[model samples]
Each structure stands twice: as structure tokens, then as C-alpha cells.
Target: MAQKDPVLALDNQICFALYALNRAVTARYRPLLAELELTYPQYLVMLVLWEQGAGAESARVSDVGARLRLDSGTLTPLLKRLEERGLLLRQRQADDERVVRLLPTEAGWQLQEKARQVPARLMCGLGVEPQRLMALQQELRSLLAVLEGSAPSD
Candidate 1:
């Protein structure tokens, strides 16, 4: 049998860390969301809509997918759920009907205060400062670019 590289060990894999981090974060959000009867993905969509919007300048499902590394098959269904919850409205663009725009409803903004503490709460657990977080995010972006058929230019 051929031997595997020591560096390829599971303990050294970033995917394992990412998986664990997601699971742990989801666990934290679960109890918090039970009060609002929302799921993690739903909350993610809300976060996108809050940060973006339903219009071109606001948000579209494709834009969300791009930012989240998802696709329409996954995002379209989630967008439907958000629409059903009255958290947002989904519609085809007037000029470009092919583009689906996701606009948050009044209820979505209404819940902002409810979740206002979540970002800081999660960050506190990660124990990374804002500037450090930005640096790490940039590194992750570079890593993602490398994975996505594009080597990040320095």
C-alpha cells in the first residue's frame, strides 16, 4: 500500500475546521432562532437581504448565491421559504425578467433589532478583532479564488 502525505491528515485539513465551525455556529443559532421559528439558512437569507435588497442595488438570488457560494437550485428554494415567511418578496426584474430580485418585507427589518446582537455575539466566540477578521476574510477570499479556477493575484 502506498503511504499518504503527513500534511494531508484530517487534522490538517481546512475543510474539517470549516465543517466543525459551521456545525458549532449553527448549534449556537438554533436555540436563539427557536424563539423566532427560523432556520439557519433562512437567517442567512435575511442577513443577505438586510445587507443587500430586492432591487439591482439591493439584492437578487443570484447575488446571494454568488456571495454565499450557492446556486439557484439551493437558493431558489430558500428564497421561496423566505417569501412564505413574509420576510421578503421575490419577483422577476421588470427589465430583465430572467433575474429574480429578493426584497425584504417589513417583517424582515422588524426582526433586525431581534438579531442585532448576533454578529457581535458570534464574533465574541471567535475571539478575533475587526481588523483581524478583515485580514482573515481577505485570506479566505484568496483561498476561495484559488479553488474556483482562478489563482488569486497578489
Candidate 2:
């Protein structure tokens, strides 16, 4: 009988590892995010908007989409839901009706304060060291950069 091929093993697949890790991390965030009335994607969107700071003109729909690596189709529904919840306003630029700008509302800014505990809470629940997680995050970012063709290959 032929021996099993190591390359075909599920345990040896990087894609499966990443996929599993993504699901695990997102699941861990579920309850914490629920407290903020946000799903994982919504929490990511809010993080981007909050990082942009409080302003009349915070970010364009394109800017958010680019930062999140999401297409308009997927991002639009999330933005719409957030807008409907009074967390943000989507307004067309006066100069160009096609250009949509996102402005976080006061309620959205207030939510930021409550969300401040989410990261620490999630890390505590995972029982992982913060420094180790930071290192893993950097490595993932490097891998993503290469996959996106934004980084030089060895």
C-alpha cells in the first residue's frame, strides 16, 4: 500500500489554518461585540470610523472599503445598517453626488468608549499573551501584504 501524501493532509494546509483561526477569533468576539450591538464586521467598520476621529467629513465609502479590503457591495449594507441605527450618516458629496462620505454620529462616538474594553476582554478570555498576539498579528500582516502583491518576495 502507498503511504499518505503529506502535502494533501488538512493539518498541513496554511489556508485551512488561517480559515480556522479567522472563525475562532470572530467567534470569540461575538459576545463582546453583541454588547455594543455590533457583529464582527460592524465592529471593524466602527473601528475604522473611530480611528478617523470625530469630524464633519470623516471618510469616504471608498476609503472605508479600501481599508477593510471589502468591496462596495458588501460594505454598503453594513453602512446602511449602521446609518439606520443612527450611528453614522451617509451623505453624498455636494460636488459629486456619486461620492458618498461617512460621518459618525455622536452616538457612534459614545459607543467607542464602551468598546474600549472589548480588545482587552477578548485577549483575557483567550488567555493569550498580548505580546505574542502582537507578533502573530505582524506576521499575518506581512503575509497579507505579500498575498496582496504589496510586499517584496524573498
> Which stretches in model 2 have alpha-carbon errors above 4 Å?
1-4, 150-154
- Which residue pairs show collisions in model 2? none
15-69: candidate 2 lDDT, tens digit per residue:
9999999999999999999999999999999999999977545799899899999
TM-score of each: 0.74, 0.92
- The TM-score leader among the candidates is 2
Q: Rate the local accuracy (lDDT) of all candidates.
A: 0.80, 0.92
Q: Report the Cα lDDT for residue 10, model 1.
A: 90
Best by lDDT: 2
How far is each candidate from the true structure, as Cα RMSD in Å?
A: 3.8, 2.5
Q: What is the Å distance of residue 10 in model 1 from its true position?
A: 2.5
Off by over 4 Å in 1: 2-8, 53-56, 125-138, 149-154
Q: What would the TM-score be for candidate 2 when compared with the true structure?
A: 0.92
List of clashing residue pairs for candidate 1: 53-58, 53-59, 54-102
